[model samples]
Target: MDDEVTTPDGLRLAVVQRGDRSGPTVVAVHGYPDDRHVWDGVADVLAGSGHHVVTYDVRGHGRSDSPPGRAGYDLELLAADLRAVCDAVSPDRPVHLLAHDWGGCQAWHAVTGDALAGRVASLTSISGPCLDHVGLFLRRRSPRDLPAVLRQALHSWYTLAFRLPVLPELLWRSGTLPGALVRRERVPRPSTRDGLRGLELYRRNMARGLGRPEPRHTGVPVQVLVPLRDAYVTPALAVSATTFADDVAVRYLPGGHWVVRQRPELVARCVAEHVAAAEGDPGTEAPALRRARARGAALAAEGGRAGPASRWSGALAVVTGAGSGIGRATAQELADRGARVVVVDLDPAGAAETAGAIARRHGRHRAVAEILDVADDAAVAALATRVATEHGVPDLVVNNAGIAVAGPFADTGADEWRRIVDVNLWGVVHGCRHFGELMRSHGEGGHLVNVASAAAYLPSRVLPAYSTTKAAVLMLSECLRAELADDGIGVTALCPGFVNTPITTHARFAGADDAEQETRRRAAAAAYTRRGYSPERVARRLLRAVEKNLPLAPVTAEAHAGLLASRLSPTLTRALARVEPR
Candidate 1:
């Protein structure tokens, strides 16, 4: 339905409502240079989910009546308009607020002040920070924060341009501004009138709000969606809302400034999750939302013993082969960062030892042990379901379980080849398949790290079976990375060389007698010991790879050199593969 909401200032704002009238109300407010139509895509999705979605144009935009002068565009007046609309729409119930850009600024003002006290249930702000919060953030900046401040200042350059007398208005009127937005942000063509009148928002509020900002606080739950690629707002500035709000969650999304238009389904999913979290039973809050709580508040609630805050705090991670070597080290590293880790290994003693060590350092709740053979698809799928039901979906998954095989290709029988491929290749495949789907269904992004080897790319004669399996894993990781990009999941292939680990002791050597196999194993182990590389180093690189979302991470000096050589000269690599070890 379409109607006119008359604000106390005598301006008539155009309002549109959709979805079931009996459902909980969600009021969506659009940013500058956009009208109620900016929320069309989001509203449709929310409406389908049974939310009474409402969208409206603020004063001086769309069908709304323009104020007589710039003085009428004060922040207080904008807050009052929000109050008048909420009172007219649903006076009995507290409505959830979803806002973008300038609309978020107004919503922040309303919720922070008494204008909408007890009237707003929750607030979801996208690409917009409260002017007062931004002011306080700048006022409290230190030397270490100079880079962040500078980045934000560069983003706000257009805010300064808007302060100019008539240049901004001319740009909008000439279609230059709208054209730029379409080309740069991929947003639909915006109306010139909305662009022209919205300038008052900057002129009337920017200086006063940021220069002498008030101590604004809100008791309402707030979710700040920080778009990593936002052109107008830096993620640091966008997340500053955590400073003032009592209950706040900051979620980092992958998109530009106009993410609402670019990824409406994603925006809607996040908004709905926040709204449900606000309205549902507190005990049943989503794990992602719980982890996203402001660092200070979460730490204080936990009795201030969670150690220093980290990006991985409260995250859940699953690592296979966590009994020894790189897998155990990675599990411990994640736990040190405040993540709850699930340590899975075929050996019960190894898994228990890893988990026990983590528990000793970070409390008993920090880690759990599970026995699993990764080659079994059914078992892995069952584990994925159980983990989701009992511990929530994992935010990070590391598939590091594998066996090694050595000796000539001709001597490697079908059974030996099958055994190595089952553990090395199929194990990674099962982890990615089950857990990747769970992450996609949850609508929140996660990371996957698959452990390959330098043998994946470097030609090898003595390690033909091992090289083939590792190569297949590397190719699988690359393909999955491309396929899962749109779903927000990251896939990384970790290739390490000559790490001092127990794999050498267990490797099977084809065509060799039992005694000869044992001798070769001792020789290989001694050579690796001489190289002096540690699994802990590979663990650190794995974390960095996930953090940066790197497609392929080559650890150890030899791994890097081998990768370069294989890519630069195929003939030389092949010739080197023919040399027999002494």
Candidate 2:
């Protein structure tokens, strides 16, 4: 059940209760520009499973009171609201606190503040960091007051262009963008659009205050979650907060800005591990970290994989978004090398074709394709249950359903924008949340394959949101890589450069369906189509990256070149990039 509590400062806060009141209570503080609903994934896991979870809108965001203007938007005020929520919700209990983004900053403040200091048994900070170094997030904040509002009106051409007077009017009234963003991140997706008004609040006040500083002064056991590719909070920034405390433990997972929505189970497991530790249960062991590097070294020593390799030969493998491209290639590759493949896709016909082809070549039953949409939460959960029951717990799971998006940030319609994010990015998240839990419980270590892009590493002006989502995917994958490493689950990030796929057709263009754009993409992909390797080439690279336990995998010579340019000679890459007319 859920209800709203007014903060002492007169802000309305939403608090959700799960299980009995006596259970461990976790106050989850979500970051800037987002509401309490940000914690829905983590909240559900805790509540439905018996722990007590409380979530609330933070000042300007979500369903909470926005007040009249910027007068209420400041660091101290934001931190104060968090304390008020805790006081109102679980004043007596030794609460477990989980925070992400801005909430992480507030949690840092709470741990340091005189009020609730030492009251928290354990804390988890996700994709946020110490306040001082949060220049990355700060650089993007909106200025205070009317000037700030005007700044959004001016510099935020992307947001303005997305809906404009017409589309924006419709989206705001219909609440499509906010609702879709929320629904995309939630497991089986959340129902209410309560605090969703905060997206505009965030856009208007892009200038959210700095996050909590490092907890060096606090002695509470801590868990810090960092997404290596986060656009707002860099991993370095997240790591800086750890230096403040001695009891720091870290878990990194895959996905971006809103990872909890996509991979709730992964977040749930890690959060549960921390809470269980605070409650004094035997801790989730960390074996993979100590030995993953050595294992990768051993595989390299043995020369490439001979079949399924020792790590996953007998393991059940579930590959989703497998109708074509890397998904299709990976599924068939696994079957050819002898791992049973469960080919999953939203397109049943495409999936069946892939499955039938696999059958004819491998002699009947080597692979099976099931039609499904991962964005649909119930569908994902059902798939997880069915796979566990039919194929047994899959030792390997791949989140690969992705579509291509191309266009200037402006003209892409809301539905176009929402669908790309839901499928390409969030789909993997849903799979990880549901399937990851199933694999973890089976007691057999499993591997997760998330298909992020080379785009994950950099922000592209042309494909603003698409690039933004990939960056999130990269970070989310990296976070999972770190956390699951100890669990003997090797996480591989398939970060590919441009490959020939149908992603081109779906590319959201600015003007008409101009022939020029198609011609350009064709010419660019022609480079690959010429000496081009099949998607199987990428699949092979992916398998090798997994066996080698590489933290990141780039798929093309162009990708390797870009890495050298981005890392070794930034100016050269910039100059070369500008060599072509924009």
Candidate 3:
């Protein structure tokens, strides 16, 4: 349906509505130099999903009636126009807002001021920052934030050009401006009239709004989509909404300013998810939204930073082999950093112990224990499904389950080799295959950490079976990293040297009698203890590896040294493999 919405200032705005009228209303507003057509792609998706999606041109754009002068483009009047449209479309209920660029700016003004008070349920702002928020961000600048501010200034060089007297208008009239936009932003050819009149937005509002920004706050749940590749707005500025809104979630997308046109389905999906979450729908709480709430509460208490309390705050993590050693320590470490951890292990008692410790330290909901043998592909797949259904998709998965088999290649039988490979190598494969699929399907990026060993790169005759399995895991991580890069999933292989853990005591020794096996276990365990590297240290490195998205992380001095030696002199490493340690 097409209609004319009259603003309080007596201007007729061009409006179009789609989908069933009885459904929840979603008012999508377009940016500068673009008409309601910019939202055609997004509207089609939202309307098909059973939303009453509305798109409209502002006062002086498209088929809308233009006011006499620049004063008509004031933010206050634009906000009033938005309010009038919302009242005309859905008077009885609060409507969700989808806005981009200048439209986002006006929507922010409406939600913050009394223009649309109690009328907006939520707002999704794309590639736009509230000028007041930007002003305050600049006013409260610290030395550390200067680099980000400078980067934003560089991105916003065109705003200065827009403020020029006649150049922008001349360019718009000459076909050069539309050509530049279509070539650079990959947007459809914009109407020249809309392009010419929208320049008033920059000239009329920019200086006044930014020079003296008011304190703007809103109770509406706001989702800011910060396009990392946007030429007009930097992520730092786009996320400044967190400082103003009571409920704000910032999602960093891998696209440019016109992402709505480029990836309409993805943008529409995000919008629907945010709207559903605002409507209190079950299972609609994404990890980013949860983190935003947690951060908002924390900021309310401390009046501190605007971002997450910790990088892992409100993140969901799955750590396998959490019965003890590196896995247990990693679960605890992630819990300490504010991540909810699912502690998985083959031993039920160990998993419970780790969960209990985490619950006592953080809270009861921070940990869940599951018993699963990672080598079993079906079991791993089942666990992945349960975790996603119950706790949402995990942001991090650590494949740390493994068994050690130290023996000469000649003495190691097929059964022994199979056992070690299944536990050490296939365990990682199972975790990655199942959880990685979940992450990809969820459309949210995550990280996978596969724990290999220094034995992966260090050739050792006594540890031939163990070395082969670890080497396979290392190569698998590298290959998976390359494969999943486009899907926004990161893969890491953690190689640690002799950490003081229980693996040595449980390792199988081929061709050894029971007494001799016991003696070898005792000797290996003691040697590892003497080396004195702790699993906690390895756990810390694991966190760093995830944060940095490192492809290969070598933990402990000997691990680093072994990796360096393997690269520098394969001859020397092979020669050392011939000697048996006493």
Candidate 4:
């Protein structure tokens, strides 16, 4: 239904409503110089999800009539306009609110003040900050927070220009500015009248709101979406609003200021999750939403704490073979860096135990476990799907699951060859193919680590089958590294020479009977133990490789030597490989 709403100031505002009226009402407010049509992509998604979606042009923009003077565009009147929209759409019940840019500024004022405090159920703000909050943020500046303030000041250069008298209107009406906005900012072609009139928003509110800040507080559950790559609004400015709101959650998405247009489905899903949680439907809510509510409740319960930020604070990672040894150590290492971990293994018990340990060490919900056989393509695809649903796309993925088959190639049975290839070679393939797709679709840069071995480059006559599988993994990683580079996804092949892990204990010895196999396994395990390397040490190198986006990372001393010798002194290395180890 398309209708008109008269604000308190007697301004005729255009309102467009869609979806079932009986469903949860969601009112979306557009930013400066942007009409309600900017939300067309997002509104369709929310409507399809069974929410009653509403989008209205702010006064002085779109089909809405502009008020007479600059004072009419103040936060007070803008807040009133928002209140009127809410009253007309869902007068009986509170409506969920979503806003971007200047609309977010006014919505914040409305929710924090008495304008529509109790009338708004939940709030989701994207690429916008409360003007009063920004003032307070700039005022209480510590040495550490100064850099963020300065960075934000740089991103807001246009705001300062917008405040100028004649030049602002001249640029908006000249027809050159709109073309420049499209070419430079990638913004959709804006209406000339909308741009000319919307300038009053900044002129009327910028100095007044920030010049004298207020103690704005709210009980509403607020979700702040920060666009990481926004040109006009820095993430720091958007997330700083969390300091003012008691019950607030902050989420980071990979996009520019016009993220809704680029990733509408993601934005819609996030809004739906927030609305569902507000309605007490926790079944479909994301883990992040649940955690956010719990955190906000805790902050309100027991005053907030000031803690330094960590690299892994908001990051998510998935580690295969995390049940034991190198995989377990890697998962723990990533968690220590502040990342939430998804611990996966072929063994259910091992995966659960590892996940439990991580959860206990960090927070109970920081780590999750999943039982998966990487060799099963369908199973791995399902795991990828589940992880994306439960948690957002993983920032780091470690394909570390592998097995060992030792002895002469001729003596190795066909079944043993197949088993080793399936677990080691095909498993890496499955993880890369499935998880890689998730990372690409996310549009955010991520890293993939494939655990190869020094044996990949080191020729071994006795360990032919094992070496072959490792070598294949190395090549696959190299190929993926080149292919996924443009997508901002990095691929690294980790080659650790010989670490003290349980692989030796489970390794099968070909040409030997069962009893002899047991004897050989023990001997091999002893030799690896004598090498005195730790899985933890190898794990550190793996993290470093991801941090630097290294294509080939050789972990141990022997690994480095093996890689160099294989390239420089191939004849000598091959001669040494021909001699069987005792």
Candidate 5:
């Protein structure tokens, strides 16, 4: 049953207490930018099994009191509210606390203190920080303040404008909120229904406690479920949280912070396993739980990008076409993440510029820019041999070198077609033929990433040659992946949309002059070119795919939509494709 409770301070909290009135109890906390619905799935599972599950809208969220002012809006206040709820909800039994995102920080505070720590049976911190690896996070993001800092860097104007009180009010009224919402059932429209209170909570939290580090653990048994694609918290934090507490269980989920909505089953199972172990069920394996416990403590030692476990330290990765494109973007991302990169490009100045920028950003030896034409098989072969000897099988090989040419088949000459095929298609072939063998002979395993395009399957008549070459590259990569799977080497075919890159300047049109053609084609093509994401986005997604051992990476709206539509009906796809707007 749901009820409203007014605290001593006059803040009204919406509380959800369901299941048999007499049963074991659990408390679920939600972090910033969200509400208590984050625990709806886990609560349901627990309730069905006769556990008294408790959830409430954190202050300033979900019809909770948005107490005006930053004075009472920090972690301390959040923790106080939690303790009060504990006293009010389940004073008899030791409560099992489940927290995610920022709520995990409050859990760290609530479950660690003497009184609550002893009464709490177990604590699960999902995708929040215990700040055990600050040095590593600082290094990963050169300038520091990785999470909110990166958001500020990305959304500069929002930071400047959102701080003004009542400013979001005007924008919220402009229909910007509803347009931003794609699915109303799950995702609320802009500002959202039952959302302003949450926004106010976030506003005060950010305004007052932006720089405060999360409080350390209360020494309770903690289980940390880290999402592989979390943008705010680093994996280093999840792995390191165990350093402070002796019993920490680390698990990986295959979703975003919105896993409550995206992969509820996975989240529910993880919660079940953690609860089973805590409850000391004879059916659960204790030794295996200990192994999981050890991972939260020492996996950082195994996967640390900087500390002693940095085997890839100073190792060189050869990246081709390293200019102001995906090549440059990947070079920066790798360098930032700790890897020696050999920037290869036909443009000496361009390569030098990229290397210089990377060095400036990361404050290390980012890359050695070498001018070369990858299409020339001998040049690429020699470069591979040099890179192998220079840096042991080039731990990672990203074949992101390619060119694009677009025109009607009538206007495109054999020369134009062959040039595109030579660079886009054969370049990948050269990379595989040479690097694949070098890697197999070198050691345990390595990753080979090939950059294809969405045009491969979702064919585009406007870009015939480029699409054909990309299609060939996609097929080649899949074949290589199957062939190499047994040899301990992994292959990933990356098919991204029209990323915002310089190549868009050459994109063609049917019959107009260059100026008019660009103007006409710019809108649809501009989807990824103007407000479109950077090559860094694709690079990040590619790295994540490699970590998860994914075979194909389709990285764009058109790519994902086409795949979904085709999977639904291929022949019907052809019919629908004819009607799709250009």
Candidate 6:
């Protein structure tokens, strides 16, 4: 349904409503030079999920009527316009507010000031901050925050240009402004009036609030979706906003100012999660919402520096083959450090056990289990989709599934080689291909840890199949790291030597009789047990490698020595490969 709502100042605003009116109402607001249609993708998504979605054009943009003078576009009047729409849409109930750019600026004023007080249940701000907060942030900036402040100032050059007298109006009227927006934002060419009338937003409201900023605060839960690549608003502004909000959650994404157009599904998912959490229904809360609640307040309040540990405090991680050995240990290590973990394994019972242990240690929702054979491309794709749909895009992905096969190349059968290669090499391939796509699609950078092995460079003739697969994995990691570097995604190859694990007991000894195979398995397991290295130690090293973004890491002392020897003394390594194990 489309209707016209007149604000207190006599400006008529265009409003569109969708979904059942009986459901929770959500009001979405757009920024300058854009209309309610900017939220078309997000609105349909939320509406499909049973929420009553509302999007309105700001005064002086889209179908809304522009007021006569600069005084009409003041933040106070703009806030009143927001209130008017909220009142018309949900007269008896509070509405969840989602806004971008200028709309977010006005929404911040309304939510923080006395205008909408209890009328706004929650706010999900995208690429915008309150002008007063920005003012206070600049004033309070120390040497540590100077660079970020300056960077933000540089990004705000357009704002200063907009304040210039007739130049901005001329650019808009000549279609130059609209062309730029079309090129950059991929949005439909906006009306010239959108640009010309919106100039007052910068002229009247920008500099006025910087001089005598009020101590504005909001009790409403706030989720800030920061586009890290936004040309106008720095992510630092989102972090700074924590000071004024009682409860705040900050998520960093990878997009420019117009992410709503570039990645609309991601925007919708984030907004839905925030609204669901604010509604006080835990059952309806998404993983992102749960993580946000767990993250608590921003780090700025405590005066602590932010890093992977702090950033991933409440983030989600997905680990494959997390049933036993290094996989299980890595899953436990991550969960203990405050990340919600998804434990995936081929064995259903093993996966459930890992999940149960994590849940018992952390909260019940901190860990979940999924059964999968990582070699299955379709299955891996489905898992990736399900995780993104249910848990949001994972912040870290560990492709740790593998199998062990031991024997000389001449004795190993084709079937044995295929079995080992399928699980060891193809498993990692499936995980990376599917989950990596999800990370890229979400427009948020993530980490991928592929578990290779020390045999990758050790040059073992007896362990032909095993070493070949591990070597391929190592090479794959290097290639992926180079490819994804520009996108902020990090890929690492984790190589661990002999460590006490169940892999030895389950390893296949090609060309051996049944009795001899069992004997070899037992002997291999005993060798690993005597080595005294543990899977937990390897797991810890894996975490560090990811945190540091190491391209290639060799865990055990032997692994490190082998890597050095492979590079510095290849002749010696090749000579050693000819020596057969007893």
In terms of TM-score, how similar is model 2 to the real structure?
0.46
- TM-score per prediction, in order, is 0.91, 0.46, 0.91, 0.81, 0.49, 0.80
Q: How close to the true structure is residue 434 of candidate 4, measured as C-alpha lDDT?
A: 93
lDDT of every predicted structure (CA atoms): 0.88, 0.65, 0.87, 0.86, 0.68, 0.87
Ranking by TM-score: 1, 3, 4, 6, 5, 2
Alpha-carbon runs more than 4 Å astray in model 5: 21-23, 112-115, 130-164, 175-186, 190-194, 207-215, 231-240, 281-283, 286-291, 300-582
563 in model 6: Cα distance from truth in Å? Answer: 6.8
**TM-score for candidate 4:** 0.81
- Report the C-alpha lDDT of model 6 over 204-237, residue by residue, as the tens digit: 9888987778768899998888786788888776
- lDDT per residue (tens digit) for residues 1-582 in model 4: 789999997999999999988999999999988999989999999998899999999999998988988888989899999999999999999999999988889899899998996798899998877888878766756786777778878888898899999998888788888988899768789999999889999999999888999868788889987777789877666665665676676665767788888788878988988998888765667766654454444333322221323234557889999999999999998878667899999999999999999988998778999999999999999999999987878888999999999999899999999999999999999999999999888655588999999999999989999999999999999999999886668999999988999999899888899999889889988988999899999988898888678999999999999999999999989998999888
Off by over 4 Å in 3: 165-186, 189-193, 228-231, 280-288, 295-310, 568-579
Cα distance off (Å), candidate 3, residue 504: 1.6
Winning candidate number (TM-score): 1
The better candidate by lDDT, 2 or 4, is: 4
lDDT agreement of model 1 with the native: 0.88
Which residue pairs does candidate 5 place in steric collision?
A: 60-197, 112-218, 177-190
Candidate 1 lDDT, 1-582, residue by residue in tens: 999899997889999989997888999988898998989999999999999999999998888899999988898998899898888889899999999999999999999999998999999999877898788766655665667778888888999899999899889988899999899888889988888888999999999999998878898998888777788888767765675778887776767888898778988988888899899997788777777773435543533212235457788999999999999999998888778999999999999999999999999989999999999999999999999988888889999999989999999999999889999999999999999999887756789999999999988889999999999999999999999887678999999999999999988999999999999999989998999999988888898888888999999999999999999998889999999888
Residue 472 CA error for candidate 6 (Å)? 3.1
- Please estimate how well model 3 matches the true structure, expressed as its whole-model Cα lDDT: 0.87
